[model samples]
Every structure is written in structure tokens, then in C-alpha cells.
Target: MKRILLINPWIEDVSAYDYWLKPLGLLYISSALKTLGVEPVLVDCLDRYDSDLLSYSSGSGEKYFGTGKFVETVVPKPDCIASIPRRFKRFGFPEEVFRSKLQQLDHVDGVFVTSMMTYWHYGVSDTIRVVRQELPSIPIVLGGVYATLLPEHAKRNAGADLVCPGTGMKPIEKALLFLGINKSVQPDWFDELSPDYSAYESPHYAVVITSLGCPFRCVYCASSYLWRHFLRRDPTKTAEHIEYLVKSSNLSDIVFFDDAILVGGGFKTLMKEIEHRSIRTRFHLPNGVHARFVDRETADLMYANNFKTIKIGLETSDRALQTSTGGKVFLNDIYRAVDNLSKAGFTYKEISAYIMLNLPGQSEEDVLDSLRICEELGLSPTLNEFTPIPGTLQWKELIERGSFAEDIDPLLLDNSIIPHWWKQGFSLDTVQRLKEAAWSLRRKLSGE
Candidate 1:
């Protein structure tokens, strides 16, 4: 059988955390490759539970609910952001460990590497460099969010033999074809396949996507752009998959990574199925859900199904800004949703609201007002620092209006680094103040 090596690269950034971070796309691709009669060898750099990693670190870094910090090593800053006064670090397995893993692997036909954030392209490039050094003759392929959003940049910089830049099985098929494998991937692979978690041993949590793509076209979001249409799996089948994970893997926590999980009524049905099966495990919705969909029934279902983390997307409380940016939620919708969640027995600690900072045309007062609303509703506030996505409407508007050069380094667009260079948005001092305010509110809500 043909063997293919799959790699989840290290995240090179100023800071990184493992909030149940699973390479869902890579795992799905692994499953697809398996269905095509290929063997997949996984080298998940972020797998904290790997025995080799545990031996290297001398212990695990796990904190509460399978969410914690990644093992980090300080590295030299890239010339583009070298002047930024923060330490640039690579967060994942040590370099020697990665090299050791690669050396131990048996003969493989090709190597596939997956990437995440666009700003993390440096990580992708570095990963591909190491792969090339270790296996000089093997073909390397790169695909993921970064590759899809910045195909040209990835092609120029990522150093992949072939850069497949699309979603679903199309990219996988392309990679397979590039390797002379004549397998046609099914279009309905999203519904037919589950992320291959078998590669992980003793994982604290698992992430499942009930649906792909978002129906709402928020200017700042890339979900609608990445996925052309919203596709949902059979709720019953999804629940069965969850049950299998719970029973087979002994997983206690399951996270929903859907961009718009609650857009349709499917989430409610899925929750009902989980309840019917009496699958006793914690559920988390770290991705913000639409406030308009959090009706009493939905909130009740979430609470009944043991949802431990519930975050509502209340990007901004400004009425005009709300309408201007997708109009997905308004003040009253937030109020009603919070009321329903509260009535359903969710406490302030279990619920939170996402408030965006540094958005174009947004003032400091707008963000402060949104935080005040979260305070009034007794929900913790999660201040999301804005990062300009390349293909979004906001990105095009920024480029057209000369906010920054179109060929600007993607690293400068990172939320942590944007304030230092981008003058159009809030300055570094102002962003610091806003973060402090949000942190204070979270501390208050947590009774700290």
C-alpha cells in the first residue's frame, strides 16, 4: 500500500494556546486518504499527549478542560516584525524531537503539511524547510486556511512542491493526483467521514463540526469565502460519532468548531439526539453562536446537553455598526439570548460574549460600550483583537483605501502586532487599556 506522511506544523507566534486545538482539516484528509487505500503516518507537532513529547517535556502542560499552553521555544524574530518589541517564539515540539520523529518514519511516498492562521505562514515555511531537509526527494504539499487565503504568497514563500488552495476533497484529490494516485474523492466526504482521531492517544477533548460554512457574510469573517455553501451532516450520524468517541476514546469533552453551528435548527436536533442517547460528556461552543438563534428552547437544549462553554457573537453594541457588519445580532437579540441562557440555568461563568476591538471605523468608545453591555448582562467578555483576513470585504476595502500596502507582510496584520504598526486602528496603548478593562470584567465575573 502507498504510504503518505501527514504533518501538523508548529505554530510560530508571539503567544499560543491549546484551546482544544485539533488539526480537523488534516485529520479529515487523513481519513480520505485511508478510504483511498493509502496508509497515513501522522506527526502532530501539537499533540501534547504524544509519548515522545511527554518524555521531552518531562510531563504534560494540561490545565483545566484540556486547554493550556503549548511548549514554547524563543526564536529569532523575522525581519519584517523584528522591530516589534515582543519575543517571537515557536510553540510546539522541540526541533530535535521533530527531526527524530521524521527520521524514524518508514519510507513514504509524499508529505502533506497543513497550516492555520495566515500570519503564521512563517511557521509553515519553516516546517516545509525542515521537511525538505529530512526527506529531500519526497514531494511536499501545503494546504489549509493560510494556503487558501494567500495562495500566491504561499506559493512564493511556503516552499511546497505543490500548493493546493481550496476546500473539501478537491484539494486532497489534487494532492493525490500530484503524487500519481488516481483516486476520485467523493464530494459528500464532509458528511461521510469523521476526523481520524485514532492517531491521538488519551486526548483530553475532541472537536467535531456539525456543519461547514456560515450563511451570514460578515465583513470581517472568512467562513463564507472559504466555504461556498453551508453543508450540514446528518444530526443523528453526528451524535452517533460523538457517542463513538466518548465510548471508544474515553473523551470527556467535545468541542463544536462550526462557523455557524446554530444558524439552522440542526443544532437543536443534534442536541436532542445526544440527549436521547444519554451521551454523558461536556460540550463547548467556543466559536461564537448567533444570538438570534439562542432562543429559550435552544438555550435549554444546550444546558440540558451539558454545554460548559457558551459564547454569543455580540461583536459590537453600536446599532449602526451592528447593521453595517452583517446585522447578525442587535442589542435586543443579545438581551433576549442572555435572558434565555440565564433562565436555562447557565451561570455567568459558563457564558461569555465576543467583543471585537480595532475594527475599521470603530472607536474606543464603541468597544467600551460593548464591554459595559456584557457587564450589565453578567456575562464574561472575550475581547477579540481584529486581524485583517486577506480575502474578506474588510481586507479589500483596506487595500482599496490604502490602509496598508497590498503586499504588506501578513505578520504585521496579527492582532498582537497590528497595533504597533497600523495607525488606522487603535494604537498599542489604547489596545492595552481595552484589554485591561476586559480582563477586569472577567475577573469580576469569576469572583476573583
Candidate 2:
């Protein structure tokens, strides 16, 4: 029997919070391996329920709506940013715990490691180093956003035998063959395999994606580079999987990780199925939704189907900026969507508007205008600092215009750095003022 091990690497950053973080791509690979009759074991570093790690934390790991914090440990700063004057930490199990977990798995034929956010490659590098020391001969394969975007950099620095990119499973299949395991698992994307989260121990929430990729090519987003094309699963089958998870696992919270959920009536059809089956669960879209798609009918369906959390992308009120950055939503579109959702009984607190800040040429006035607009519409404003992603339009333009260094390390792409690291003309003080304005609006709206 071929037994493979999968590891979700720790997140190394100045600050981190668990906003329903799960290695969905790695879980899909596990599910596909299972379908091919291969045994798979998982070591999720960010498992909040792990009693050993929870024992070290100051607070119990209870979560609200399946969103919470990860138990973290302070770690040394990378030499590149040592003078940044912030406490760098690893947001997950301690190193000893990870090593102990790896030691427990016997006869591991091969290993698969996954990464997120390209800038967190330090965590990926550290995880691979530990794996090599423990299982010297076992071949390790790396995959995920970081691997896909910066394949050569990850291959050179991540210390993995092979780096697999994109959604296809061909590279992994080939890696297994190289390891003397002769079996072929059809790619899960074609079959639309439901990720088997049963491997998790008492998970509070499960993430499901009815669709993959977005049609709109946002300048700052890398969805097109990672996915290449938009593909959606059968809505009926998606509803069935959701029903199974809710009933069997006694779970109430399900998050949609789709880059864009409403490609072609996908959201409406899935909601209708859930309503017909009477599957009552709180749906969440931490990934922003397209404001233009939310009409009167869609809003009512979302409310009827119990969408507890809804975030619409209104990146900027500047019409030119909006047009250049995919133009998926207009000012009128947001206004109408909020109106429809409000009429359908969703309160202002339930609807959140995502306003992007700290883009290449974004000004303080632009950001402040967006916040004021959201406040006027009675929607909670959430500020998202822009990160320059590789292979995106913004990245290419930044490099061409001499705004960003061409040879910049991916680690510097942290969103937290904001205007200080990647702005065109904004000062740190201006960025601070913008954050303060956003916070004040949020507090006033919440009546805090």
C-alpha cells in the first residue's frame, strides 16, 4: 500500500489571524489520492483543536462562525527584514510539535507540502527544512499559490524535490511515479471531486467552492494566472455535498472560497437547490462578491438561504480606476445591491464593503472617498491593503514603469507593509490617516 503524507506549512509573518484558513488545494489532492486507492495522512500545522498546542495559548480556541485565531509562537526575524522592528512569529504549532507529528507516520512513501500567500515563503522554507532532517530520503513535492506564482524561486529556496503549480494533478502524479509508486489518479478538477474534509478532527467549518476562477481579470488579482480558466461544478452535486457535510458532520458554517461565485447563474442555482432541500446553514463569502450580480432576486435568494456574511467589492469610487481594475462594479451597482439586500432583510452589519487601499497610484483622497461612500450606504467598510502579485497586470505595469523593482523578493509582497513599501506617492502618515478614518467609520456604524 502506498501511504502518502500531506503537510500544511506554518505561516510566518509580523501578524496573523485565522480567517477560515484551510489548505483546500492540498485536501483536493488528498481526496484524489484516496480515489486512486492510495492511503493519505494529514498534519495540519494550523489545527486549532490540537490539544497539545492549545495548552500553550492564553485563550481557549473557541471560534465564532468558524473564524478565529491560530495559536502562534514568536520566532526569529528573517535577516532581510531584521531591522523592521516587529516581532516575527509563526502562526501554528511549535517546531517540536511538527517534528513529533512527522515522526509518528511510519512507512511514508512520499510527502506533499502546500503554501499560501507568496510572501509567507519563509514558513514554507522552514517547514521543508524540518521535513528533510526528519525523513532524509522521502521526496517532498511543493504546491499552492506561492509555488504556482514563483515556481523557480520556490524550487530553489523551498528545499522540495519538485514544485508543482496550477490546479492540474499531473505533476504530482509524475512525482509519485518517480517514487516507484505506479498509480494514476485522474485530476480532481475534471471530475469536480468534493474535498474530503473528514480527515480533519472536529473542524468548526468546511470550505466548498462551487466555481473556480473569475471571468473578470482584475489588475491586482492572480486568479487568472493560477486557474487559467473559469470552471464551475454541477450546482446540484455541490448542494448534495453541502448537505452531506451539514447533516453528517453536524456543521452549520460553510465558506465559499471561489474567486468569483456567480459566473453564470451558479450562485442562484445552488441557493435554489439548498432551499429546496431545506438545508439550513450559514453561508459565508469572505472572498468578495461581484456587486453587479446582486439584483433584487439574487439578494432575496441570498437572504432566504441564510447567507450570514456578505462582502461586496467596491475597490474604488474613481470611475477610471474602476474601469481599469476590471470594472465589475460601479457606484450605482453598489447602491442598488445594498438597497436590494436591505429590502430582503439583511442589516447593514451583515453586508460589508471591501475597499482596496495602497495600490500603485492610489491616493489618500481616493481611499477616503471610498470609505465615505460605504458609510453613506450604511455598509461596514473593510480596508484591504494591496499586494503586488506576480503575473498580474499590476505587477507587470509596476515593473515596466519602474515603480517596483523587477528583482524584488516575493517576501516583500506583504500586504501589511502597505504604502510604505509599495506606494507611488503616499506617505506613511497619509496611510495612517486613512486607516484611522476607516476605523472611525466602522466604530460609528457599529455603535461601539
Worst 10 residues of 1 by lDDT: 416-425
lDDT of 2 by residue, 254-359 (tens): 9998888966787888889999999988999889888888888889998998998999999898888888888888899999989999999998678999988777
Q: All predictions: root-mean-square deviation over Cα? A: 1.0, 1.6
Candidate 1 C-alpha lDDT tens digits along 1-448? 9999999998998989899899999999888988999999999989888888888896668887788778889999999987778999998899999999999989999999999999999989998899999999999999999999999999999999999998888888889999999898777887789999998877879999999998899999999999999888989889999999999999989999999998876888999999999999999999999898899999999999999999899999888888888899999999999999999999887899999988888899999999999999999999898888999999999889888898888988887765645557788789899999999999998889
lDDT score of model 2? 0.84
What is the Å distance of residue 94 in model 2 from its true position? 1.3
- Spell out the clash pairs found in candidate 1: none
